[model samples]
Target: MKSYIAAAIQMTSVPDLQKNLVQAEELIELAKGRGAELVCLPENFAFMGEEKDKIAQAEVIAQSSEKFLKTMAQRFQVTILGGGFPVPVSTGKFYNTALLIDPSGQALARYEKVHLFDVNLPDGNTYRESSTVMAGNRIPPVAPTKELGNLGLSVCYDVRFPELYRHLSQMGADVLFVPAAFTAYTGKDHWQVLIQARAIENTCYVIAPAQTGNHYGMRHTHGHATIVDPWGTILADAGDKPGVAIAEINPIRLEQVRRQMPSLQHRVF
Candidate 1:
């Protein structure tokens, strides 16, 4: 278990859930062919549609008999990180959440979006996530294989908060996964920089899978699925293209960087 290969699948999802699942299956097969042990899909990989009504309609929760997740993981024989989906909430609302499926098709962990994206940028694109989606409370990390160790799980907007990464790292995570459907305005300006900063500061590898291109309605995503090293180096990046990127994680690099900086130990604030 020296190192493992991973891939991030970018998609231009639409209103049709079945069609999107088919596309995702094709991408999973592609990733398997390319020797990816773990593959991550972009946020809303299942169904991106007209508006809140569309997402709310497609909400699914911890149901055990989900064919899309269970069958896909078994078919690929690899860890499938299904990026955020619309989940039915208690108050008849929905929550954007990520689900992790193991090779055997069993769900390992599920993490809901903590920090919903509610912003009115200068581009006149106002997003009110709270209107439809419910906020999550706990920070969940997945313990995959003994060789791979613990992985911090986060959704799109969760990337902006450094405290989240810090919490994950403190909880013994060696890698962090952030699946996003970021807008073009923010992705172009801040996506890479923010991800790298988090990785460098935490001394952990950051694997981000993103949605690229326009969806069914007017929603557009900035697609650049990237993997960054602990030293803040951009190991792999896909620029506005739907494809996969791979990187070999070196544990020695993390140890070396941590030894050099020791920033994690220098917290006086």
Candidate 2:
């Protein structure tokens, strides 16, 4: 994998699909302008609304979201990760899916979110993602790109589960993508901490795109789209705003850290 710049895009997506797409395009353009070759959009970059409203428009959302990712990737001539969108499933529910598209608009990898967010926050917000999203049965895939390193895919709440990332690392992942629309209540404390831990433990670069600001009524997200190196250092952070966190993903730095630490090589279990 050659060295390249990656961008984690932060956005305030709402119920309007077109508006969200426009916002995502603008951010992607900004990232590309900043020399980002691998651009990632946050979860729900297409649409974020009530569960009922989302399910009702699931088919439309799925089609439009996939098409948008492909179009953007081809247009920008850069690899893009559309962090989480709804894909209709056989169970009449949808899978929370993350997709990777290459510069030629060809799909490289896809992952359905395995872990669901089902929690009641102290801030008077409750999320039951399983109600609308079908949990994926299979483990996420690591797409080995000739230029981008082995890219591992996961979405949102999966950051809380270290075993999944361990599995990715075991599969030879050099970069992990943890795109999320994390709740404002839980994010202030857990978000960065969890991401850094995953990067440190796995000795992989983490490119995390995030949703920030209020989306709909009573739905606000903590926004700190970030990129961390294998050393668990924050290379770039877009703090609580709609923007891109651009950082260089260097193979030399990755190998240097791995050699210096060698923790992953000493794993006993």
Candidate 3:
């Protein structure tokens, strides 16, 4: 096993793709300066203007958006989770997509958001993300590396579903990611607890980068980009700002936690 540093970047992305990308690049460099080997960005880190804008900005795989991320990863010599972007699935529909790029700039894996947000919030704000974004086919999630341990891929809404995390763990995931853009209404109450629960039950490291502050004047995201260890202890947390939280992931600690609990092996269902 190996030990390495990880970082999660919180952002309050606006309507501009270029500006968002610039912010992400600067943040990635900053994380690298802090000796981070793996970096994750928040959901919708590229554009968050409107539904029409999201549709228009959607890119196909291997296109400009992915190219930019690969270039950045190679330049910084660090593995990067490209966060969530809208990828075209059809003429008017897109998939909420996440991709990981290695230090060599090769795309390692991609995870489209499986669970879509379609609910009415307590603040009278209603969203039907399924209206524009199509549901992913729900494939087995995969991330991380030989040295970093297995990483399970997830998006914002997927956090509410424990079975998905369990399935990923059964698929050999030792670490989990919940790159998100959770609404302020729900995040203030449910975010941290859900993320830590996933870590505790799976006995896996959980990295969750998030959107923060206000966007488009109509939406505000709760920003507490955090990293939790297998023992359900928070390793790092970024407050309500656009920044990176850095922490060292100790493999020894992860192993010890799993070894002591052994609950995963005791599952009957």
From the highest TM-score down, the ranking of the candidates is 2, 3, 1
Tens-digit per-residue lDDT, 1-269, candidate 2: 89999999999999999999999999999999999999999999999999899999999999999999999999999999999999999888999999999999999999999999999889888889999999999999999999999999999999999999999999999999999999998999999999999999999999999999999899999999999999999999999989999999999999999999999889887
lDDT of 1 by residue, 87-125 (tens): 777786677778888889887888888899899978778
Q: Give stretches of model 1 more than 4 Å off.
A: 59-66
Question: What C-alpha lDDT, on a 0 to 100 scale, does residue 94 get in candidate 1?
Answer: 75
Could you estimate the TM-score for every candidate? Answer: 0.93, 0.99, 0.97
lDDT of 3 by residue, 1-269 (tens): 48999999999899887888889889999999999989998888888778877776677322656887888889999888877888887557998889988899987789998889999987988899998998899774786588777878888999999999999998988889899999998999999999999999999999999999999967999999999999999999999899998888888999899899999999887
The lDDT values for all models are 0.81, 0.96, 0.88
Candidate 3: misplaced stretches above 4 Å?
60-62
Task: Identify the candidate with maximal TM-score.
Answer: 2
Colliding residue pairs in candidate 1 = none
Task: Between candidates 2 and 3, name the one with more favorable TM-score.
Answer: 2
lDDT-best of 1 and 3: 3
The CA root-mean-square deviation of candidate 3, after full C-alpha superposition on the true structure, stands at 1.4
User: In angstroms, how far off is 34's CA in candidate 1?
Assistant: 1.1
Error of 3 at 9 (Å): 0.4
